[model samples]
Target: MPEVRIKKRFSALAGAVLAAALVIAPLTAAGASAAAPVLGTVGTIEAATSDGNHESYWQARYASYNATCYKHSLTESTVHGAVTDGGKTVTLAPFQSSWPGNGWAALIVNSGTSNNVIVKPVAGIAYASPVNNGGQQATVSHWIVCKGTLPTPPSVVTPSLTFTPASCLAAGAIVFGQNVVWSSVKNADGTTTWTASPKAGTVFPANVTTSWTVPDLTKLSIDLEGCRPTQPSADESETVKTTFVCAPPLATITTTTTKTPYDVWDTTLHKWVAGTATSSDVVTTRPLTADEQATCEPEEPELPTTTVDTKPWVDGSWKCGDTTVLQTREVITTVTPTEGEPTVTKTSEQQTRKLTQSEIGTCPLVPGKILSACVGDVPYLSYSVDLPEGFVASSEKPVTITFVNGHGGEDYVVTGQPLSGKLLWPGASDAEPKMWPGWDLVDGQYVETSGNYAWTRLKDVVVKFRVNPEYETTVTYPEATAECANPALTSVTPDDPTDPTDPTGDPTDPSDPAPAPSVTPTPASASTDNTLAITGGTIQLGALGLGALAVLAGVGMTIVSVRRSRKA
Candidate 1:
């Protein structure tokens, strides 16, 4: 896109030069009496107007790309520039090349514009052809057709460059934020004058700086012409050169899990946080220690118990065979019971146990400590502490659990249940009066007497629990007493037989004959009235409907009688 614009600007400049040259041609022909022996020199004279301004001490710089021959060579210009088409052939024109002290040597830039006029030198002039550089590809060309001098550089604008951030690891791009852009100015000399791309807030002769949000790139290239350190005469055009500082996305940490310094859950984040302190903070769980494992208790043990089987005995019953005498059938059920002693083996576990002479101890409820009888003595043991089936343990408080060292070493008992409440100390008795292993333990039931106590944890945590108080059920117990009067009967009528022979009427003897029922007739009951009467809240349908109809008829007859009396 930039190249196309450059060409158009030069084309306009060239056309104007040709027009002015043609105009001068007629004059040259009229004055001279001979055909010109040399090719026509393109030139432009100052117009009738003046700006009263001058360009100060102009300078030049050398720049190059691959020359026309593909070899490197320095050209006396910033970018390839030309007035007319540089690719076309043109006749030579005379121009003075004052390089440093190398005074006035007839030279021309070939291929493209080798130099541009900062201050319109004398009347603007252009070569008909590119300057010859010995090598075919190393030629610089400049064709100028000017009016009075190249239009004074549009305006000197200091090229200001900056990046959005200045650093990033993403693609960087230069975007216009602020600054004046240079424009191509067409001159009557048949040449185009263009200034550097504009920067916001730029003033003539003053350098301006602006900001741009660079894209995800590392480098930005601005291509334009007429910008050089040596040239301070005109507002040289520029494509812009912005240096961006980019920070790309952090790299992933490629280190494997085992080799990684951090316990990073995601390896990709390693690069991002590699140098940070958090790099060592990876997702992980603490391992269980040997002592910690000792605190854990295994699943509840399977208690040994026996299964019993028994056949029920059904007695004989008498039934009428649909006629005369009743017959009896007896059913006898055989009973068989399985008997055997269960082989029970207790597995060793890490648990805190009450200290005992035996290697193992059992937790059960009793009056006091297990006993060796004293003169047929009653054994007194401590009441067992247990959780009810529906009990959801809130917490466990320490209650001097004895840690026993078995054949293995140390057995530290630990239940998975969490602890709650406060620590239980020594010399504290249980909630009830119970015998300890001995009178000595009675005072220090919870205290560790042996120095070895510190080696193992006494984790007998007592759980304080309760059921919903409102749900308590109270049962009333009837007092037992001897009854000599009569037993209240159920499903029996008053005429039911008591007994025939026993004067005491005791029905205990099954062999005794049953007494016949006796009922006395009541004369009042003999007065037969088969009617079902409607009383209470009940309405006898058949009787009720008929009674209602009768009442209605009687009311109608009375109403008619009254009406007749009134008429008479």
Candidate 2:
């Protein structure tokens, strides 16, 4: 039925006038005891609105399809009116067994803002046989008319804020730690923008932006060089200064012992270490003292000495003695007035802090598709992993799965109907072959003789898998009907070619020699004979034999007109 609404200025007057003609009063049975008064009774139900904000009407046109029923004989089972205002609804009393007429029947609703006029189908309509003498099944229809906007309700909210540490992968050097407050607002386009403000003694900028399609957390960083003091180096005035002086009364030789400091190699550190030393002594002549020079003798002869051999018949030689000289000469001394350049050792420092943001929105769950199927009275479930829609998976890790058989999420098998034979998927692969159930695998498929049989018969299989800790999904394979086609035979024993039942004569019988085998190169081009015969080990040339003959001829075999038969 079509419904039409027209706007009217005189809503209050129009509602009252329409109620007299359209509204039907509820009828009570004669002598019916009053338990509770029925709905839609005139004078018992009050009008929803006296000063109407809007006004409209709806009519339901129905007809009986049975031949014996008149067009105006059908009536509505019940009728009720509901008024909605300020998000709250109130239903007026209903009219029962009403609206049986030739023309349109009106059900008035004293409505404000929005109204729903409901009409229910009667239990039965009088009709002739073949329709079962009952009314056809019908559904209740609702007609609504809404105008003036309703008042919106106030939303209740509790303010909350949180701070979380950043992950090791997302953390950076010199990460600033700050006590900040964050607030988020949803935009009309379904995107969310997050703003942050630092508290006392805190420094940094934080931000987050997200939407239904994408989520992004901003990484905040501030350059410390802009506000911090500059690093300093050692002063140049601390460098060491050295000088040398040479002035003495006479030349002198001094003997002294000295230790040389050196560094040793450390194998573990792969570097040199200092503080070890080696000592030695040296001798030289000194100048004569003033008291010893007063008693000194003049002109003493100097002699040299040599090694002498004391053995028999050996000669000894004498030489001049050694001499020493002292003279007025210069002396040298080295001095350092200051220390050398200072070594400045600098150590690196890394400061880091964590960052976290509130969750913005939720992602709609996408259902996974089941890829399992049955082949030849056997079920082979898909062990392959795939990411569902609205999700992205990382390739760094493998997907883990659990297979469940039967119903009610429990494992079950029929006592007498245990499974037989293996479920084979010829070229299919399992991610974890070792973990596969009791089945002997050949290539990638299951072999019939052996199998990891957990269930005798798989009516349904449930697959639960997880791509990672964050994403877990479940999919199901419903009952399947396998196409169990009959297997074809590979080879068959030949029938007696000379038997009377055989139509085609024998080619191996010499009494009636058969024509020579066809020399057609292409086996597909040859006409086939249904008869079968054998001469020695070879059979008569048939569809497949024609190709063999061509191969033999290509190998330089002579083609003969008559074929050989078995010797008697």
Candidate 3:
């Protein structure tokens, strides 16, 4: 029995060895006969959907394995292959997988014959590193199988971009962070580049906030791509724009007018001609023009008035008759005899008798004609005589006497007027005998009397006068002056009163008295005689008290004279 058992065991071992050979020999032969070991006849490998929502399946086939096949299972296998779906090549890798034949084979039964067969077909086969066996070790054909057709990739909807600051930013303005939001981003290639508009080669995060130094205030754009990076596109968000300004520099201005005289006399005109004096001669209490008034500035004051007198013959007169007879004669004559006397004279014989006319001639004769004495060193002619009754001297008559004093000193007298208020001699009308001459007297004084008078009647008249030594009078005037508050900023110039354009009008006009001119002192010629005198009846005097006068009645009247000195 041991021998018979040994034989059967040997036969069984041999049969088992033969079956192992049958399984191993062809694989070895197939490996030797074929060019390379290949997982062939790959049925299909596909992703469930293009939306990344469904799973992927890989179906593959291996060459026939005759002997009973062994199975090996695989977990987490990565399958990679280029699949054409709708003419577009798409690559995929398996993330997970399962296998019922332990990743090796599947069982099958022949329908016609009652034969059970073990077949190794690569249906539902799981793969790991499908190309080169994950490291150049394995070779396999790959195909994708899907329940439905693969969908297209979603359109690349570019993200919207925006800048913080608007246009025209000032210098040193802070640049804030930017906002980048996505509308849609579906890239089959799994790689893309995001870029800024206007070719801002700045890098940014995929889907997050980003920041960059603004090189300058300018327009910008943004771009997105799955294949490669590109410049900003027109489809990017709205553009940006800004400005800057500096403070204006401070400005300064200055204005000025020339300074000129206030009052002056024109010597060539000979009259009291008005001319511009120095600015010092102007007296400005208030502004004259609106422009000046706005400044509220004061000007220089005016000069004071200096007065002079030129009357002559003080308290002296020309006598035409003797002291006794001159009083008795009704009207005196130019020629009189001093040798004859009106009273009877006693004869040498001592007889108390009326002396004969011849004897009277021998007696002492009363003085008849006498010449009036001259007063000052200035030469002046004088005449006096008794007047006739019926043809009386008109009180208004003006005597024309040449100024022998050589300086225009000839003066006339008006009768029947006060010395301080005499009507001017040679009055305006000849018919009015009482009217005196107006302004015909020189130096505003009469030759005879230092008193004012009116021409009341025609009668005897006595006068004496002299002329002024100088051509023009120099007067001292008072004035007020002002200073500018800020000389560096502005300066004030005194106004001229003598200017014809002076809107203040004439100072002498009672209706509009101009402000006084400022005082500018200057040296002048000295006066020969400081005292003035008059010998006529009445003399009208000025504020300076230099005047003469004359008085006349039906009959001739004696002349009166007076002398006065000017105030120092």
Candidate 4:
């Protein structure tokens, strides 16, 4: 509301003294005349005319001022001096309005004065003339004696204030195990700050109900008389209020758990190796021992084996004896008992017939009586004489048999050869020789010594001894002439040699045959193959394979394989 600048008219020039000012504006009075009010008092409040708004405090006051209000009502009126802005109410001094109805009231105060007041008529509604409360006309008469505008001020009152205890809480809360008690505050200016606490030495449980006392303002007092006449005065003490608190809900609680898993192991390295982890809640691992590794990973195989059968041996046996072999074999022999006596019908085979020249059994030179001869060479005649009447044969020392050939050729050896005692003798091959004794009757003992005979060298040296290792004993041969020409061995019937003349003057002693062999069996031959060294080592390749092959070939056929190898 705008300040009313009262221009005193000649008739109203009765009185005017200015010190401070205020203008009271209120809500409208429904539909009454809003004319510029005369110097009349209506409803104790003016309408909000086309003026600006103002708060309850008259900030425009320049100095101390005297205020008065007149009151009259059909009921005891409670309004002191208040206004409403429709939604909110402003209060002022409760300075009692002491006059009777239509009488007067007054007060003295400085600028910035404040007080509590009743907002309006209580228990009933009332208003002044020309301003009705709602639809009812003024059952009450009210008026205010206030300055409207600022007076040129030269007077001022100043006072200092101190809030001694500053401020306090309205409550205390249990923090941890102790109560955070709040203290009260009081100012030297008669102001107070209210607070609450568990009285001294008092404690409370957590989250307890708690509160603080609202301080009594009436207990407060102000002194303005001491203020110098030129300073602002302290009006009244203001009330400060703060909230209280007890223990809050207990602090939030929490728990934690961790998770993990274990691991496994492997094998194969003879040691433990790792495998996939075993899953669990907590973090974990484990080393695998040999036993555990067997269960965890694929067991490492016995480091795989690779072998090459290097130099497999070729096993074989001669026609005469068994030899060493690499593989295995088994032999079985069955014995049968006969009900009757068994016959040993042994038909012995003879490889040689007793040889003779000119007469049978004259020279008596048993071909293999003591030494061997190559049986496959050209047949020849060799002679020997029996000891005369007082002589004997002795084998006390080693005797050697050397071979000499016709046509001034070299000598050769027939040891370890396939020789027959009665078969046609073989011819000499290329080599050298030393001579051996025919016989020597020394000290009544006949010793066959070796030395060269001082005789004319003969053209041909024939041998009559042969030896065989394959066909032992059951050996036979055909007669042979000394000729191997045309290379076609001529077939000749096996005939016994039968030429033997007397041992005359100079014959038979110097060119006698070597000592005869203690005769053994010889293999069968036609005296055709001359180079008979060793023979018949054809292996039978296991009787099992041979039988299987023969069976597969249907009883009449056999399978044989021949292969030649060289020895380095």
On TM-score, the candidate that comes out on top is: 2
Candidate 1 lDDT, 21-124, residue by residue in tens:
44554565566555422222322212111111111111111112111111111222212223333433222223334212212112222233223222222223
Least accurate 10 contiguous residues by lDDT in model 2: 65-74
Worst ten in a row by lDDT for model 1: 559-568
Global Cα lDDT for candidate 2? 0.27
Which segments of candidate 2 are over 4 A away from where they belong?
1-365, 375-379, 382-392, 396-398, 405-451, 469-481, 484-568
lDDT of each: 0.24, 0.27, 0.23, 0.25
RMSD of 1: 45.3
For each of the candidates, give the backbone clash count: 64, 21, 91, 42
291-350 in candidate 4: lDDT tens per residue?
433432344322211111112112332211112223322222222222343322222212
Question: In model 4, where do residues sit more than 4 Å from their true spots?
Answer: 1-311, 316-367, 370-403, 406-568
lDDT of 3: 0.23
Kindly list the per-residue Cα lDDT of model 2 for residues 249-327, writing each as its tens digit. Answer: 1223323333433344444534333443443434343444554333233443221111111111111221111121122
Tell me the lDDT of model 2 at 112.
Answer: 23
